[model samples]
Target: MRKEKVHINIVVIGHVDSGKSTTTGHLIYKLGGIDKRVIERFEKEAAEMNKRSFKYAWVLDKLKAERERGITIDIALWKFETTKYYCTVIDAPGHRDFIKNMITGTSQADCAVLIIDSTTGGFEAGISKDGQTREHALLAFTLGVKQMICCCNKRVIERFEKEAAEMNKRSFKYAWVLDKLKAERERGITIDIALWKFETTKYYCTVIDAPGHRDFIKNMITGTSQADCAVLIIDSTTGGFEAGISKDGQTREHALLAFTLGVKQMICCCNKMDATTPKYSKARYDEIVKEVSSYLKKVGYNPDKIPFVPISGFEGDNMIERSTNLDWYKGPTLLEALDLIQEPKRPTDKPLRLPLQDVYKIGGIGTVPVGRVETGVLKPGMVVTFGPTGLTTEVKSVEMHHEALQEALPGDNVGFNVKNVAVKDLKRGFVASNSKEDPAKEAASFTSQVIIMNHPGQIGNGYAPVLDCHTSHIAVKFAEILTKIDRRSGKELEKEPKFLKNGDAGFVKMIPTKPMVVETFSEYPPLGRFAVRDMRQTVAVGVIKSVEKKDPTGAKVTKAAAKKK
Candidate 1:
């Protein structure tokens, strides 16, 4: 028998206390993938804590501080196999400090599932930092995905299973937060981990989960970039208004970001109808759909084209199971929605380009350059050159994880034997590719589209931040601000911004401390990539636009081959 190979790499993300772990656990169990030993251990632990209902999902609480604080601190990876696919669930922390990790994770995902909570309803008091929700939106815009879904969780308190009752209970709660919401009052506990899938018609998906909460916001950003699609989760009862407004506001922000990032479609889930009045749930769902539709309209999307669904992840009602509770509601369930998502198009035939993620020494291997292969094929005996240092190497061998391979190409994770290159010779932010195909060299002047993050407090004309390009990190300063453009419309924001702010997206010229490989976005996206970082955090992301021409100094000599030709 063929080793039954179907893999779906997906992530879970959202505001904190939105039940990311719980939802993830539920999916594992619902799919019959959880081990009995793990469940028993969790039961024993829950018994000690006096919460019998706590299942194996608690095992996901890996960190001591996370368990105590009820928050995710790091991104966790788990695996489960279905009749149709083997899935890897990446659980990312919702905190702000972990945003870098989140970006890393998002860059690896193919699709995403965004979670929201019903208890707190929406953006709670003190739940954000410097308008982090807005930041999340901005980051999501960079993660060009196709499918976006939303889930509203935690209506379990009402105990109403009827669709009508859930609708009634949903409308009772409203006006929680919006512009007045701060970053302090947001709960850190996740009540459920919602799931959604985005599919494109072209390539298999790698999904991401961005859970809410200051702790896991990083996870959301990282997860989103890797995904080709995404989903939003909301609670049907308590989530009605919360999902419609505060939570809805955030959803719009994220959705808008996704749209800006090139996401083509999305699905919204109204979870937890089992514990709410059918009337409240229905009313809430209607209201939420209307609000989301109106927002989409304002943002240039047709209102009638929006997709929303209602379900309860906890009770397994309308999630993967067909609930007897809603015979009146005729539509596909959450699972069906997931199944319906089409995979994104794969630009595998595009030019060979690799984003240098890291350069490290591996014992006998000397120096190793690690990064995801964005396009084309990597083969042995092929001569490749990395950024600026312009070190040329012959591909002696290729290895991934540990397995040896003759050649690796797009989507393959492998390392090459770069002879004569030393640990000190190669650093992060350098790319290794066939020099014959790529232009890996320093440019004096280049246009770049940058999303400015946090810049240094003491600003100056020549202040430089550590630039993160693929795996290479070097000191780079903005040489000039050619023009500022609207992040959304690409319309000019300012002819020049002396100082770019937190959410600004504009084009500018930069100078690197050292000569490094840089290229125009049109020619080599891999070498064109870069990120800005202060000592504390990542400040921005960008791609080189074009290179400025320089004057030739050396005496020109005609090549013998050229003369002969």
Candidate 2:
């Protein structure tokens, strides 16, 4: 009998040059995951380019422009297996320009692995004031990565250490360090998520490596929102953990945001312990635990339940195997911790509601709509209704993952052909459901509870912002501010507040400028939650409380005139 495999999605995240790609590539290679021939080809190419040090990174940086530029410009996918699990690795770009790609990659992850550089100044630079490291971490936490693994890239640390030693022999200055780091910083970025799989001894894991630059925070939010857990990596060297958790750093922000987003579990990894002296490593470990635990407590996390492990990605210590260097530390290996993470319960028993992602017209398939089933079931031959267009069509066929199926359930990403629906009649962001049972309708106006995330100035009635709900993006106006409420307590504070500023929560009436399909949050959450964007950034997030249909307006006939006629 074939063994059943459990699946988990994981995303890799960190600042650029923190060895996110290298660590991921090396981990997969160390597991005997990469094909020998592919590695040989990459090695040969690196040798010919006189950049042989990039051979490992070449595994995921498959694009010619990326290899030439020595950076990951898009999401690269690869799959492998462990003794008991299958895994998918999503290698996302780390450059600031490709943050959109990172967001796309992170959005589908169930867990996250944050890679940190363990070099003397590397960690400091990454988590420094206004560094991408903190932003990426916070983004992962806010997006819902509850369980996390922090992997400090010791290989890069060793390389940097050697370079620094050589520079010191030549009486190097800070400018020299900047020059060296600058050379590694010039590379292109990407904006798409790649999908791949691997397996461990106990479960299947899908990993996404998201971008870490500040410009990509939007994408990062989108990516992390789908995760359930996260792993935080810290360098096991002097000043490593301190700098990361400092006020200007993102460690605290990431943890706090993750908690706010409902991620309840986290794994803190102290990486590069192998590179430090036993005494120093132990001391650093103790210091980090104390500092991080204190901060996590302030952020409302149960610090005692968070597992802290010491590992070296380069040396393969305490990752797939237990490390002997840290005799004092006793905890599960990185892989083991991943296997122990509990899968979140999926809501599949609700009514059928599939948010249309795209509409395509295949040569033979006619008109087909594609999307993930957010709730309930979809089957061929069912008469489905799509709203706000109110177009009714029959499902001619269903296809998922390139295979035909009689029916599709929640969480399944499927594309199905529809009968009597023209390509022009359909658009993205429409909801498809059973025509005879609770047919979808166009929402005329809705009341919502909103939390303002960002805004340049105060917002009053008639303030228009783009509402992003499911796959639908439409402009909506604040018809009225019914009440202002406390963000934490949800207590009513004021009625009809003149204006709302950043960080404020309120109950407001909203009217979409165009037709939209929305449901009350209490009834269908998948379609009820929305993001409000203005001036190109998300200003608020809201949930629909109730909707008022648009009643037709017409001229009334007078009773006296009717009698005379």
Candidate 3:
């Protein structure tokens, strides 16, 4: 008896110069050998196309059959059958322009094949120079396969392991951190956020390990925005320390971001202490602390108050226990420094401000708006007002993962069904707040303190760029350049500067291109701090100092909300 063939979907992805198309075509061409005559026909077809006898043109011969020459933007699908399974392959384009197609292909793929040129300069042509191998990262994040989340290196522990196993020597030191998500550790890089909550000596701690991957900078913003304290990890080895703290390093960038995003408290861990030339050298540790402290001061942090803890993450020295290797150091261990952090007051007592992440209409549920509560509490009986249009509705039910809750607090992502609210009436950017208490409205214009971190060109009045605040992404115009200010002191530096260049801090008045809900940093923090996104990168970051709100006009109120009022 013959058995039925199972179906499989494979996606081919890589950098533009990485021969994705060539690899895909070769696979199909070789599979053509399954039918011996088909291979001969392909050779005949190839010979006819390359009658010019150009060996260099032979590279284009196979693609010519597919009718695509230079850089195929669209995904090409092909089919072939094996003895046990039927396979469908998608030739997903590798260029950034075709990211949507790549995302589409990646999501549908049962397996993804990343093609590499492997040749000298061909490998250097794209992608890899930056820390991320974006192809594998896209696949890992999209599929959420392999949990790649055991902090992706437990960064190698859910329970911190004591020094054990002689095999866990030299490079094996980090084996424990990567052991949890062993597969990704083979890549030897953690390209994404590693969020793990564990109790320290004094407080329950959440470590949002924001690795310095340029592609995931937005993740850094999101992680630091919620953090009460930032754990700054640094390389203490000879060249490693210099490379990490240099102008091009991401450590300085992250520190600046953390300070800008309101992570007032921080613990600077001088990591890889064991790897120092003389082994846990106090001289090396002091040198790093001196340089980092000066850099932190420029970023607006009071370096004197920030604790510098020396530790080796790989060797597990001074992370939880004091390192005898460095008896010269008297400071508390990593865990002890964490215990010193003073908890910031929770915003639950403030007026409710929940930025909608998504809106959905279910079979039985009317309209559900899902978001994390940035402040205050959300309950079933409350009258909710959505900003921009001031659409009002009464919350019929509040649920987290299909289970009803009495109230949802800050940081709780919940989907609440609203009475008389249609799906069209809500969207991701809209702010949901208590109807009768400090309700959110659209902003006409706002004043903000913006620091240009990375911009290809100068930013001046009338330069409109997309601003990412909370769940909203809107183009906001720089209405006026008020004054350039000293980053550390916030003192006026220049009056109405012609333009703000990279690393310049200035007060600017902004006008949104569309309806956007924003509040002063003092009032609603999550909605106040925004990333100035331009050219597909976070060119600048700003904190809303003040807002001029537009009064609501002809706003819609649900029947349920009206009756309650």
Candidate 1's residue-wise lDDT over 1-565, tens digit each? 0135233444444434344455555555555545567666555544443333334335444443343334444334444443343344444333444443334333333444444333333322101222222233333334433454444444355334554422221211110000001111112222111122222222222233343444443333433333333444443444333432342233433433333333334444555544445432555455445544454444333334334556554555555666676555566665555555444344456656555544678775676775545567677766666555555666667764355766665544445666666667666445555667653555566778887645545333466876544334467778777777888798997886676776778887788777655666566443455555564344666767888734323312223212322
The TM-score between candidate 2 and the true structure equals 0.70
lDDT against the true structure, per candidate, is 0.45, 0.54, 0.49
- Name the lDDT of candidate 1: 0.45
Per-candidate TM equals 0.65, 0.70, 0.59
Rank by TM-score, highest first. Answer: 2, 1, 3
Q: Write the per-residue lDDT of candidate 3 for residues 369-453, one digit (tens) a residue.
A: 8655778999999999999889998999997535598987664446899998779989867989998899999999999998887
Clashes of each: 119, 54, 4
The C-alpha stretches of model 2 lying farther than 4 A from their native spots are: 1-3, 28-33, 46-107, 118-145, 158-190, 228-316, 324-328, 353-373, 378-446, 452-479, 510-521, 524-544, 547-565
Q: Deviation in angstroms for 496 in model 1?
A: 4.1
Q: In model 3, what is the error at residue 39, expressed in angstroms?
A: 48
- Provide the RMSD of all predictions against the true structure, rounded to 1 decimal: 9.7, 9.1, 17.0
Question: Candidate 2 lDDT, tens digit per residue, 1-565?
Answer: 0137544555555444444555555556666666767656555555454444455555555445555544444444444455555554544444444444444344334455555544444455445433334434544444344555555444323244544532211111100111112122123222222334456775555444433333443333333333344455554444554354444343433343333333344555555554444332666556555655555554445556666666665456677777676566677777776676666444567777887645889997799897556667899877777777666667878985356978775534568998756788788668888766776778889999988755779999999986756556679999999999998899999999999998899999999999888888677755666666566344566768998754223322223223323
Among the numbered candidates, top TM-score falls to: 2
Find the number of clashing residue pairs for candidate 2: 54
By summed lDDT, which 10 consecutive residues of candidate 1 come out lowest? 172-181
